[model samples]
Target: MDISGAGALVTGAASGIGAAVARRLAAEGAHVVVADMQEEKGRELAAEIGGVFVRVDVTETDQIGEAVAEATRTAPLRAVVNSAGIGGAQRTIGRDGTLGSAHDLAAFSRIIAINLIGTFDVVRQAATAMSTNEPDANGQRGAIVNMASVAAFDGQIGQAAYSASKGGVVGMTLPVARDLSASGIRLNTVAPGLIDTPIYGEGREAEEFKAQLGSHVLFPKRLGLPEELASVVLEFLRNDYLNAETVRVDGGIRMPPR
Candidate 1:
């Protein structure tokens, strides 16, 4: 589980929590691969960390394979963080409660494809690469950290698609870890709450909106920081004893259904 001089692949590394995790891994001496769809930002961050960037759309198997391959080229792939996901909010039925007003099928499908299926595909590919590595003294080849959300548990109104996708991640953690146990590849999940990220808009209006959202937190009365979430990811990667667990990084807040 030692990360130094190893290779780490983090999806959605262009921004938000994924970006923070990528930087942290690099700082820990891992050869980080910034896998994201945003070329400009991904390349910028990769350069910043002296790492490599691979434009990856997790839903595409070919792109995911390329990312895994890229990581192996750097070093023995030992760490992977699946932080690629999208958010969608729409009521199952519109205000009028009419048939045509049902949630958009395409939108729902897209969220699931990216958040759930995409995460699984990347993990599978990464595990395959890690399986080839010689185990360390602890008999550990690698570890994976998957990004889930508090929505997977306390989903609010209009969060059907997002919740379902994250729920799928939480549900699969134990089984996936068990499957990877023989290969010495451990898997865990982090279910984060409201973290200050680009998902919130910019400028004064956005700041004001974010403040209101932060007020709901149980303590410190503010949104979580991306670095705080990244720290937990590092623990998951470095702590060989951790596996098949979903830890929530929320500031003691159980979301209220709106």
Candidate 2:
């Protein structure tokens, strides 16, 4: 789909991969809506990109709906990138060996709610808006790119909840694409490995952690940049035939059990 002069919404757009994507889309001439919980940073980014900023909590359906509505108010919504998610680290069987110390059900549920269910919610609402738009030359109305993780395939130790949530994203990609095919909306996923983002900390501590993770990568012995992931997302958006696929943006790394 030609996103130029159209509207696009990106969740978690305040920082990291989401920020990179919002910037890229704006550069490509799309009117970006930076939907994120960080009001300060989101507004700053929106101002920088000449886009709109919407405070959004992905887990809240009404908030997502509002964001989508705002995105479509100016131009026909053409793209959505669901990059809002949280990481969790807890073994199913805790090292404490206490029955009450197992992975907290609430925590697991929260991760799934935000990562999996939240992604679906945004896609559904965004697709609803896109459906009203006149189809492009390819009969395409919009494109959706979801954020998954390498953990979904090769989850390391203590990544039960994270893996499960991301796995659900990978599992649903094709089905969602099929469901939206009739509307000329395409859906795909990008699974990143050990990316160097704020989520992993900063300074010397983060460098050391990245070094450790980078050692596992097959080549380019370094952490993947957020921009690298954003590049892949752009490909998925521009390539109309690249639907119902999950592309791994890891640096050829198959994470080993921690």
Candidate 3:
């Protein structure tokens, strides 16, 4: 799809990878819509990118639908980035081995609802809007980019719940892509390795951890920039052929067992 003049809805656009993708797409002429729970940050980002700010909590279907509807008022919907998610850590057994308790359920449910269900809600709602878009020469209606993480592949300790949710997301890629294929929509996910985003505190990795990652990664020793992830989304939307795949953006860093 030609990004120029295309309407785009990006969840989690207040900061990190989503913000970068929003800015990049807007720079390329897409009418970007920044949807996030952070009203202040979301509005600021929308202003910065000359995009619309539709405050949305992706976990709510009504909120997601409303945001998409608002965005479509400008241009025919063309693209969506499902970047809204949260990371959490929990243990199956506490230090006393009391078996998973209320805290465990809370952490797990929250993570799954926000990361897994949230993505699904955004995709389902936005896809409905995108299907209404006129197809391109290749019969392509639109594109959807979802954010997964390296933990889905190699989750460290204390990440059981988090990892499971992300794994569910990564696992759905092929099926979701194939399901949406008939609608002329492409679906894909990006599993980022340790990136230099604010998600990592101060972008610091333990020396031992750094050494371990260096042993596996092929290139780019340092953390990945948000722009690197955004670049992949841009191409995925532009190419018209890439589909139903989860491309790892990690620098070959398979997460270690914590």
Q: What lDDT score goes with residue 247 in model 2?
A: 91
Q: Specify the poorest-scoring 10-residue window by lDDT in model 3.
A: 200-209
Residue by residue across 1-258, what tens digits does model 3's lDDT show? 798998999999999999999999999999999999999999999989899999899778899998899779899888899888888776677776566443468778889999999998888888888888889899999999999999999998888888888898899889988889989999998888776556544434655554554566667676678899999989888878789888998877777687
Candidate ranking (lDDT, best to worst)? 1, 2, 3
How do the candidates rank by TM-score, highest first?
1, 2, 3
lDDT by residue for model 1 (86-183), tens: 99799999888687899999999999999999999999999999999999999999999999999999999999999999999999999999999999
Candidate 2 lDDT over residue span 1-258, tens digit each: 788999999999999999999999999999999999999999999999999999999999999999999999889999899999999898898777897989899999999999999999999999989888899999999999999999999999999999999999999999999999999999999999888889878899878988987888998888899999999999999999999999998889988888
Winner of 2 and 3 under TM-score: 2
- Assess every candidate by TM-score: 0.99, 0.98, 0.92
Which residue pairs collide in model 3, if any? 193-250
Q: What is model 3's C-alpha RMSD?
A: 2.5
Where in model 3 is the C-alpha error above 4 Å?
Answer: 100-103, 201-218
User: What's the lDDT for residue 208 in model 1?
Assistant: 97
lDDT at residue 252 of model 2 (Cα atoms): 92
The parts of candidate 2 lying over 4 Å away from their true place are none
